[model samples]
Target: MEERIIIAGFGGQGVMAMGQLLTYSGMVEEKNVSWLPSYGPEMRGGTANCNVTISSDPVGSPVVVEATTAIVLNKPSLDKFETSVVTGGNLLINTSLIDRKSNRDDLNVYYIPANEIAIELGNVRIANMVMLGAYIEITKAISVDSVYKAFEKVFGESKAHLLPINKQALEKGAEAVKSLVNA
Candidate 1:
């Protein structure tokens, strides 16, 4: 299976980190993965986005012209990438920040209140992880266990204290998706 994903938001929103973790998950699973990131010149608060391709076969390039999944954390990103999602693909929106819905009806769109959930979880920074959790649950591009392994290694000894909270954030995201379906 192959998944072309776009994770986008303003800089400092952990957009690149999410892409990296996904790439790490692919690595752990022995899949072919490529990540390409772009951000505005000013860095923080500027536009930031990344394309991540995870596949069972070889990846010819790192570029993503059309994505199978698009995770948009802001309204601007929603506007920019919504149409870029392939037909019959998935679109995951951080509804806490995006007040509007997508224009495409062909895509499976999920509105996740990631920012609100993260705020409630006591760390707003994990909002990205919340979205990641939901995306992983939806696409199964990588398992939560793989993500945990990636997180544990990435956070390592220096930031070990963050592991629990991040784990909570991931599960919270998965639960949020379930709640959405049940609602």
Candidate 2:
């Protein structure tokens, strides 16, 4: 199966990091993966977007003209990619940042308060991880355990001390969504 995911938000929001983590996770799983990110001046305060593809077979292109899922962290991102999502696709919107709802009826839209959740977790910067957790749960593109392992592997050696806090952030994110749905 092939899955194309787009994560878009303002620069410094960890949008690219999320894509990289997904790409690395796919690599660890031995799945074909590609990550294409938009860089340059636009990345400053402007929109930053990344395309991540994961499949059991070789990926043809890293650019996702049409995405199976989109995690939009801002209003512009949601407005920009909302139309390009495939039918029956998933859209995870950072409700704390984006105030509007997607008009599409064929897709599943999840309005998550990522920033709020992150803030409550004691780190507003981890809003991206909050989004990632919601995306993983909704799409099941990768296992949460796999993501945790990947997180540890990626950040463990560099700043091992931050590992626990990061893991807690991820868990808080996943738990936030779980509580929302269960409510």
Candidate 3:
């Protein structure tokens, strides 16, 4: 299956990191992957976004005009890409920053208070990881174990000490949605 995901947020919110982790995990899974980040002027607080494509076959292009899923970490990101997400696609919004919802009816939207969950998990910086977890649980793009391995690979051993916490953040995100669905 081909999956295209766009992650957008303000600078320092770990949008780029999210893309990197996804790309890394896809590679580990031996899937074709491409990560395209919007950098330079747009990254300085204006609007930061990254496109990640994971497919079983070779990826044709990295630039995504439309995506199957969008992980939006801020309101501007929600406003900017909500309308562009493919019909029947998934949108994981960081509700801590977005107060509104996409009016579209053809898509499935998830409002996850990633920042609040991350803060409760202790870092507040792992908000991206929380979103990643929700995306993984919703999309099943990669296994949870694959994500943990990717995190360890990317963060290295010294900083890898934080892997468990990051994993916990991801689990909390998944659990958050599970509760919503079960409720």
Best by lDDT: 3
Residue lDDT tens for model 1, 60-179: 778887899999999989999999999999999999989997899999899999999999999899999999989888888899889888876765678777888888999988887876
Write candidate 3's Cα lDDT for 24-117 as tens digits: 9999999999999997666357889899999999999888877999999999999989987999999999999999977888998889999999
Off by over 4 Å in 3: 179-183
Candidate 3 weakest lDDT stretch, 10 residues: 38-47
For residues 58-117, write the lDDT of model 2, one tens digit per residue: 999888988999999999999899998999998889999988889899998888898988
1 against 2, candidate with superior TM-score: 1
Who is ahead in TM-score, 1 or 3? 3
Ranking by TM-score: 3, 1, 2
Error of 1 at 179 (Å): 4.9
Candidates ranked by lDDT? 3, 1, 2
Candidate 2 residue 150 C-alpha distance from true site, Å: 2.2
**Runs in model 1 with CA error above 4 Å?**
39-44, 179-183
Better-scoring candidate (TM-score), 2 or 3: 3
- Quote the lDDT for 120 in model 3: 95
Report backbone clashes per prediction.
Answer: 0, 0, 0
Candidate 2, lDDT over the whole model: 0.84
Per-prediction TM-score to the true structure, in the order listed: 0.94, 0.92, 0.95
Top-scoring candidate (TM-score) = 3
Q: Rate the local accuracy (lDDT) of all candidates.
A: 0.89, 0.84, 0.90
